[model samples]
Each structure stands twice: as structure tokens, then as C-alpha cells.
Target: MKRKLLFGERMLLGDGTEAFNAVIPFRLRGIFKEEDIQHALGQIQAKHPWLRAIITHDENNIPWFEVPGNHLPIPIRTVMRKGENDWQEESAKEWQTLFNYEEKPLIRFIWIKGEELSDMLFVFHHCLCDGGSAMAFLYEFLQILDHPSAEIGVESPILGIQDVVPAEILNNRRQKLKAKFIGRLAATAIKCIPVSKKAIERKNDYLIHWKFDKETSSELISYCKSQEVTVNTFLSAAVLHAFKKVRGNAAFNKVSCPVDIRRFAPQIKDDHIFAFGLMIVVSANYKINFAENLYAMQEAVERKTAKLNPYITMMVMESAHDALKNFTKLLKHGKSSNDCMFSNLGRIQIPHQYKEFTLDTIFSPSVIGPLGNTTTLVTSTFRGEMDFSFMGSEGYLPYSEALAIRDEVIETVKLQLDPIAVL
Candidate 1:
């Protein structure tokens, strides 16, 4: 089966020259055979059609995800693990490596071979999957890796826009007209907006990672509960506070958070490999202190989330196909308006231990692309500990400045939880 790329997928695919990659790194403490690893991946490939599909261009130059008859299995690249930081280094390198979209599947596996502790990086093109999908695959991979006979059901893939947007919305004539009109209007306005002829330079990209111990993580959760705010909101506030503290007036007041589309649309399954996502932009109210800002941000987040219309948003984007190039160009050349794209996957439900092996850690996934504002921070809790992956480029955000921001982010969160715990 095959289908044309969606608007978001088209933008991410670009010309397929540069990599827009997402790396999900985790460590396993046990003996693993290459045959078992490949078999597990093979089962995952069989369950999801996208896992084995390749990108092909049509006469109109539109990209399509097509399953080639006798398509090659997902490729694996294995290397010896030198230290704990090996996965981080390899993740950075993978971000710069382009996918052979026409010849192979969009996903690849990297096994960091070690005598007892093996760190694996499940790397894939951002156009092919999202954080939720990544986590789902990891859970399934771990299950089948331990029990090869595990019965994870197959996925009925979303082949077209129809599968994403509800049929009622697409069938209504009034909705169709509204979507077309708004899409065209937005496209025209985008074309008229002035942008820099040259894109912003983002040189020497890097990822800085850290984790909060289970005790500290639990304490922070309890603290958020007492404040009547979510751990996500509090963390957002702390992260923004750090940017302001480290970058001073140079930092943007805004942070963009991606909301999972599956929450809004039930047609999109948790296991389906899809990339579309809704977003909410947030900023602290400077007139209020950090404590007051948490409540304000929480309210704002809820109000915005409640108002989101995923069906309408999908309809509009689907109608805006002609403006794909201009929209992508605007993003690539647009002025930086936000400090960074931050996402909190919340707590991961995947089990950390199997009968054969122990799951050590699931590092927060990192994704980078050629689009505007390559800087991003992602957080997720696994095994009762919260982990973070902060990614940025030297030209956009210097490594020294990123280091300062990292330290400040941790300090700001600690100060909010407990001053005595600050270290």
C-alpha cells in the first residue's frame, strides 16, 4: 500500500538531502544476540506498514510512502560502546545523517554493543514518526525482544488524510468551503510577509542530557501537586525562567509545546506511525512572580488546549497543499520568535525489567531538523526518574550559553521545589 505525503510530512521530507532525525536511546543490561535483535525489529516491521515503506516521487514531484515488493528489512548498524556518553555522541551524529528514503525504510536501528550493558539508539526520520510513536515502538520492541512469541497486534496504517480527519468534517460542504477559504487566505498572507532572504545559521548542533533521581522527581511532583499545577507546567516555567536568567533580554519570552494528536482524534491509534501534532504556545506573565505565573500558565494551557479543533486544523492544512513550499520557506527563513520547542511526554508506562534483561534508562528523545529554530528540549519520566535532552546548534545558541542555561534550568526547578535541595 502507498499514499501521498501529508502537508507536515512534505515539509519535513524536503528534498531528502539533510536529516530531520529523532533518536530514542536506552540501555539494556544483559546479553543480547544479533539474531534476536533483528527478529524483534522484523516483527515490528511486519506489524506496521510504514516501518517498511520507502519514499518515492510522482510525476508531480509529490512524495509518496510506498511499500516496495520484497522491500529490504530495517537496517541495523552496530558498534562497540565505549562509555555512558556513547549514545549521546552517536545521536548527534545521526541527526546529520540523511535517510536513504528511496532505497530503504525511514527507520534504522543502532546497537551499541557492550559486554553486559548495551545502549541502543532507535533512530528514524522525524517525518516518519513522533515522540508518542517512538515510545510505543520502544515498548513493543522490549516486549518482543524478551518474548519473541509476544502477540502485539498489527496496525491498520493511516494511508491518507481521510484516515486522520473525521469523515463528517470532510463531507460537510460548509466545512470544506471554510477550510479552503481560510487555507488560501493564510497562504496568501504568508507569501506577503517579508522574511530574511538567507536562513539563520545553526552550526555544530549538540545535545546535553541529565536526569533527576527518583526521590527528587517524586518531590518535585508532590510540590507541583501542592501548588495546584502540573509537573509539565512547573517545568515549563522553570525552563523559561532559566532562559531568561541565562540569556537575559536576549531570550524570547515564548515556548511552543506540542500536543499529541491522538488525544484529540481517536482515529489515530497509539501504535500508528504518524507525525502530525497540535501545538500550544506559552509564556510567563512577567507582571507576576514565578509562583503566580504557574497558575496563570496552567489556566492558559488548559484554555488553549480546550479550544483546539484538531479536525478543523487538519482540514485547513490538507487544503493548503499549494502553499507547502512557501510555508516551508517561511519557516526556514523566518525570524526566531520563540526560545525553543519544548515537549514533556509525561511518565512512560513501559516496564523497565524483563525476565531476561533489565531496562536501565530511557533517555528523553532528541529531534533536530533544517527547519527554523533548531533548538528543542524534550523530557520524559521512565522508571520513576525524569530525564531531559536539550538540543541546540552553536550558531543559533552557542555551546557555552547552552551549558549555562542547563545549569540554570536545574537550579530554577530546584529552588522552586526546595531551597535546601539546591546543589
Candidate 2:
């Protein structure tokens, strides 16, 4: 069986010159045998068909995921653990390691073997899955490892655009013409515009991670509830403020937040391993107080979300496949407009307890691509504590500035919880 790649997936694959890797590091306190991991991976592969699929290009150079008569298993590499932060260094290295798309699956594993504790990094081609889908796979892997008899159901993923966009919408001639016209116009415009001969150099990428204690995390949650806004909104506000303070007047007030398309498109199940992205850009008013700025950002988020039409976006992208190269060029050569991309997976509901091993901590996943800007912050809370993974290139954001921004972000959140500080 073969299926065409989605717009976002195609963009991620790029020209096959660079790797677009997404890695999630899981910290486990107890022993996890290699055999058990292999068994769990086998089970996961059997359940998800895409796990066994390889990428092949058509005569037109478009990428397609094809499952031939025989498929290869996902590669598993074991490394000796030198220290606690060894996984971080390895993950960074994996960002540049390109996958042999024709011969193997787009996902792989790196296990850091330690005496007492271990870290497992789940690395996937960004075209294969998003953070939500990756988290689902992680949960299932742990479940199967803990209990061999556990029943992790199979997934029925959308195979093509027809599966997502309704027949009525696709069948409408006017809608089809409109999409085609828009696509052609975009392609022509992109060709007419002059692009930079030398793309921005993205070097010295680094990830800084930290977590808030349970009490502090709980207090922050309570404060968000009292203020009638989500923890995500508050965090977005803090991120904007921190960037402005650390990067000085050069920082962009705008921040891009990715919204899970699954929310708007009910047809796409939670377990589906799709990679298309729907994002809303939010900006803060630095002229106002922090609390007021947060509320304003929250309102803006609500307005943008309410207006989002995933179906139209999907159709438009499907018609614009020819513009993929132009989009990639713009991404690589464009100047950084937004300060950073912020994504909060919110509270992770995955079970931390296993029959044999217990999960110690779930670090926020960090991903960096060859795309121009490397500034990104990913947050996820597990077992009532919030964890953050901040990644950026030294060329784009100085290491010293990133450290200051990280500290300011934490303090900004804490300041909201402190009544004296608010006063």
C-alpha cells in the first residue's frame, strides 16, 4: 500500500539533504531490559502499519510512504551512559543524522544503559508524527513492557486527503477551482520573488531543561484557574516577557503556538500518527502589566482558535503541493519574524507506574531542524510537575541570553503565584 505525504510532512522531508528529527528523552529509575524493549517495539510495529513503511519518491519527485512485501524493523542503538546529561548530547547529534528513507522505518531508538537509572530517547522523522502521537506511542510501549498481556489496540489512520476532507467539500467545483487558483497564484508569486543565495547558518544548537517542583507547579495551576486562563496562556505570556527582557529590544513580540489539529478535526483519531500542523501566532503588549498582558494574549488565543478552519487549510495545502520547494526555501532563507515557537503538551496523562519499572521523570521533548530559526520551547507536565526543554542556536540566541530567559520565564510564572510580588 502507498499513500502521498501530507503538506507538512513533505516540507519536513525537505530535499533529503538534512535531517528533521524530533527526540523525546524518557528517564527511568529502574532496570529496563533490552529484550523487553525489543519485544515492546515489535508489538508496537505490528499495531501501527506506518511503523513498517518506507519512503519512496514518484517520477515527479513527490514522496510517498510505501509498504512493500518486506519491511525492516526500527533500528535500536545502545550507548554506555557516561553521565546524567549524556542523552542530551546524543539527541543533539541525532538531529543531523539523516535516515535512509528507502531502506528503513522513519523512527528509531537510542537507549542509554546505566547501572541504576537509564534514559531512552525516541527519535522520529518529523514527517511521521507529532508530540501528541509520540506520547501515545510511548504510553503504549510502557504498557506492553510492563504487562506482556496488555492489549494496545490497533490504529486506523487517515490514508489520504479524501479521508480527512468531506466528500461534499471536495466534490464542489467552485471550491476546487478556488483552491487551484490560490495554489497557482502562490507558486507564481514565490517563483517571481528573489530568494537569498545563502541561507541563514544554523549552528551551535543547544537544549536547556529544567522542571518545577510539585508544590510550585500546583500553585501555578491554581493561579491560572483563579485568573480564568489556561496554564498555556500564562506560559506564553511569560515566554514573551522573558525573551524581551533577555534579548533586549531586538526580541519579537510575536510567538507561534501550535494547536493540535485533532481538536478541530474529529475524524483524525487521537492515536493517528499524522504530522500536519495548525498554528496560531500570539503577541503580547509589553506596555501593559504582566497580568494584563497575559489576559490579552489569552483573549487573542481564543479569538484565533475560534476562527481556525482546519478543513479549508487541509484542502488548500493539498492543492498547493507544487509549492513545497518554494515553502522550504522561504523557511531556510527567511529572516526570523517570531521570537520563538512555544508548545505545551499540557498535563501528560500517561501512567507512570509499571509492573517492573517506574518512570522517574518525563523531560520535555526537544526538536531542532535545519529550518532558519532554532528558538523553541516545549513544555509538558507529568505527575503534577511542569518540565521545560528550551532549544536555540547560539547564532540566533546567545547561550547567556537563553539562560537568562529561562530564569526569567520561571520567575515570571512564580511571580503570578505570589500575592506579595503581585502587589
Candidate 3:
């Protein structure tokens, strides 16, 4: 049976942000079979329902969703063919240009026929699935390609607005009163402060791409263990170091980190849900030693992570509806508190083998938008290495600055290991 799309799903579908992109490139040993590729694409579309859905708008500028039957899958385009050395360089540019998103299916497949091997690149928007979902979709695609009769599983459907929280409840008088009071408080706070001129002028237009070698990744993990801190804590500190150097502010130390509130309450863990989860604002005052400051930052993060309550985040989001209305004014006035965002998905586990295809490295590009450009540093450990994806707006922050921030992070880590040798 065809299912209806949820509000969150529709929001992503209608929004043209590149946040929902999943770029998967596969290297094949041999190719030249059109039928096999078509069959694989069919299976993929059948398994993932988002590919079949379309976005529509009403008179109010709000987005609505619809699905088509027996929808044709977007065909794979042949992009470029380059020799060994030029493959990566040529492929990156070609793939980015070809895979740009559209309001429709927004899925693209590219086949680059090389001398000894063939490369297949699959790009899909994030509205369809996240990292975990993308991995599952890729597995299904490969399985269908190798084995035609394979049974592909569909994702658990998103809950309609009425099913999870009734629309009437949102309009309840008591809830309205609470929202009003919270909104007033948020507005008053905004009026009391001035926005940072530097933050407003510094547009984030940069893209950061970095991968840690196995040895360096191991060392980082070991260091975290020895310090008795979570990998996120250590990573967050490293990010702060990068930001400090770029901003050149000794007192600039504030980070907002998203904490998944699922496990906080056992009852809600199994409920497949999507919304902004727990968010904690952390700050570190500039002090003497770098290591000591990091330790303090780690403690602050750990404490907040431990004490976060899901209900609190829900209440804050609900009550802050009024605050969202004046977000632009608050940001312009420099009342905005968070300098950056650190999101850690921790580790992603996929099966070692999926029928005929073996698992490869997974990359996740960080995403931030709608609000003032805030730097978001996303990290996910897969297979044995860490993949860091940094994403922000080109308007508020430049992409070149973001890349420089990443370089500073790696250099700082290296310095931590050999402080005496440098002198």
C-alpha cells in the first residue's frame, strides 16, 4: 500500500537545501549490461519510497506531498572517462555538477568506463534517508544487481502528524499560554543583547573534507581512553582549537552540541521519531594551558550530556516558537550565543557483506541552514577510520575559511603528540 508523507518528510522534500544529499560512488570490475543496471534501479526505487514521492505547493506557500505509481526511475548518465591519475580530480567536479538536486526524484547515477574497471556514482538527496538509511539503500541496490530475486526491505514509515501528536493538542489553550510566556522571555533576552559584528560579517561559504588514517584514528581513540573522556569530548576540544585560531579570539569559546534524547527515556527509544532532539549550549572561558582548557571543555560536555532530559528539549522547542519569529533580529543584534555546532553520530555499523557487494568507506557531509550560518562539524566512525564532514553556508561563512579550520584541527592534534620536538 502507498503511504502518506509526514510533515517533516514534506518539509525536506519541499526545501531545496543540499542537506539531503548522499553521494555513493562504486567501482565495478566489469560492466556493459543495461538490463542489470535497470533491474537494480527498479529494486532500489521499490525499496525506498521517497524516490516515488513529489512535492507540491498550495496557495499558502506551504508544501504538500504526492506519490506516483509505476514511476520511472531516473537514468544513469555517462559523465567522464579519464586516465588513472586524473580520475579523482575529473570525477569530483563532474559528479558535483551532474548530481545537483531537483524537486523531482533528485537521484542520479553516473557510469565512468575506465580501462580495467567501471565506476558507478549514485547521488540522492538526504530527504530520502540519512547515513544509516543510505547504507541500507546501497546494500539493496547491489543485492538486486547481483541477485534478481532478492527481497528488499522497506524503511519503517514516518508517523503522520495526527498519529504522534494530534493537531488539536497544539492549539490547546494551556499550551498556547505556555508558548506565549516562553516567547516573551526569549524576546526580552534578544532585546537585551547586541549581535557580534564579526559573526555577521563572516559568511560561511567553505567545504571541509578530511579523513584520518587508521593509525591516527587509533591514537585519537587511545588518547580519549587515557583522558577518561568520550571521543566526542576530545574531538570537540580539537574543533574549539581550530575555531580559536581562525577567529583569533582568546575569549571566544562557545559550542552548541546536539544530544540524541532517544536513549534518555527507555519508553521512547523504540518509537521511530524525527525532530530536533536535545541541544545543550557549552562554554569554555579562555585560560592558561591548552590541555587544561580542553579538560574543562570535556567535563562541561560530559556533564550536560549526562543530565539532558528529552522532555526539556521538547518544551524548549515548543515554547520558543515566538523566539523563532525574531531570530533574524536576534542574530543581527549579536544576541546569538552559539558560535558553532558539533554533531557526533559516533559509529555506524553495517553488515560485512551484502550478497555480492562488500562494504566500503562511508562519508557524511555536515549540514546547517535556514538560520544564520553556523559552522557544523560532523564526525562518524565507520569501518576503522573517522570521516569528518564540515558544512556551512557560503553567505555567513566562506568555504575556504572552513577548510583552513580543518587544517588547523589536524595540525593541533599532531602538535599535541610531539610538543617537545617542535621546540
Residues 1-423, candidate 3, lDDT per residue (tens digit)?
334333334434434533444455445554447677778887877765555555555575444444555585766767556753232333344323422333456566666666546666666554454433455566567778778888876645443433333345555677567756765676688666656545455343444667787777777777677777778777777777778778675325777777765557443322232332457776655565667766787788778778875543344344553444355445443534455788777776654455554444555433433345456777877777887867665654566667778898899777765633344
Compared with the true structure, all predictions reach lDDT values of: 0.92, 0.87, 0.58
Q: Which rank order by TM-score, best down to worst?
A: 1, 2, 3
Say which candidate scores most in lDDT: 1
Q: What CA RMSD would candidate 1 show?
A: 1.5
Residue 274 shift from truth in candidate 1, angstroms: 0.7
Worst 10 residues of 1 by lDDT: 414-423
Which prediction has the highest TM-score against the true structure? 1
lDDT of 2 at 252: 88
Q: Over the stretch 293-344, how does candidate 2's per-residue lDDT look in tens digits?
A: 8788889999999999787788888888878878788888877889999999
Clash pairs for candidate 2: none
